[model samples]
Target: MPKLIKDGRVVDDQWQGEILQPEQIPESPAAPVAVQLEPGQGPATIPCALSNLGLVTIFFPAFTDGRCFSYARELRESGYTGEIRATGHFIRDQLFYLQRCGFNAFQFAEEVDLDACLASLSDFSESYQAAVDQPEPLFLRR
Candidate 1:
């Protein structure tokens, strides 16, 4: 099984899902479930019909596309509390930023070093702007 950096550690990924036709969703997934949504597919992609999902993995076709950041935050702010993951083409340098955007887990492409990405999560001790992880911006604390 492929390992993932979840909650800051490497763990066996149990969630599974096949790319179903636009009309199909696993009626009752056996274990934890994951749903893949492309950036700009919009938050409604995770509508009530798939509320049982344990994870939502957002696809980043390119590092330059930042829509996924907002997608994850919107899911959080809208109250879908399951794990929000960023996968594909993302770089280790953006791990902190991704986490701040409400992504609790990350599944980078196999070419990236998982260990390095895990360490990147702690590369910074603080952030200044408001984010899902820290709703209050740094200036507000002054």
Candidate 2:
């Protein structure tokens, strides 16, 4: 089983859903439905059906591709209350920002030290801008 950082802890991924491509929806999906969103895919591609999914796994082909960061924010802005998991290629340094963008779960493609990654999540005690997790910007909070 794959390990993931969920809700601030490293644990075995309990997702039983099958992450299928946008067009591969089964007539009767036995398990919960999860969508695999690629780097170039628009967050709106699954807009109308956000509530129907059990999870939305956004793949970061590389750490340099920051598009997934926007996708996670957009998904949250669009009212996707379910889990928005960041998987593939992202580094631990981005974890804090990823969480600010509403990514509650993370699964790295590489073999990184989970403990170090978990610690990195708290690298900063606060953020300056408004985000999915923090609606009020720092100025507004002051």
Candidate 3:
């Protein structure tokens, strides 16, 4: 089993997938679920469905394409309160930004130095703007 460092602790990771079809996700309580989006797919079409399924993992097929980041923020803004995750080709440097964008968990493509990446979450003690996960928006901090 792969290990993920979440909330500063290392633990076994579990994730379920939500197929594009509406009927694919079941109601039973299960592992955190992941949702995959093809290029150009609109977030509006799927967020509601993913939210209803409980935990959700959003995949970014490539690191350069950032549409998923916007999708995650929009999901949070629209009132989806479950766990949001980032998976696939994600880099350690992207963690803080992903967190700011509302991704609470990440599944990188390869084994990483978990401790180093976890430390990077707070590499900067301050931020300039409020993000989905930070309600105060960094600018309001005194």
TM-score winner? 2
Residue 84 displacement (Å), model 1: 1.0
lDDT of 1: 0.77
Residue pairs in steric clash, candidate 3? 129-138, 130-137, 130-138
Supply the TM-score for candidate 1.
Answer: 0.84
Tell me each candidate's RMSD, in Å, in order: 2.7, 2.1, 3.5
Q: Name the candidate, 1 or 3, with the larger lDDT value.
A: 1
What TM-score fits each model?
0.84, 0.91, 0.78
Query: In candidate 1, what are the lDDT values of residues 1-142, reduced to their tens digit?
Result: 9878898988878665554322245566565556777766856755334456677888889987899999888888887788887878888888888999889888878566687678889878877999998899999987
* Pairwise TM-score winner, candidates 2 and 3: 2
lDDT winner among the candidates? 2
Displacement of residue 58 (Cα, Å) in model 2 is 0.4
TM-score of 2: 0.91
Clashes of each: 0, 0, 3
Using lDDT as the yardstick, the better of models 1 and 2 is 2
Residue-wise lDDT of candidate 2 within 6-124, one digit each (tens)? 98999999988568776676545555588888787866666336767788899999988988989999989988898889989999999999999999999999998887789988889
**Global lDDT for candidate 3?**
0.68
Which regions of candidate 3 deviate over 4 angstroms?
A: 16-34, 47-51
lDDT of each: 0.77, 0.85, 0.68
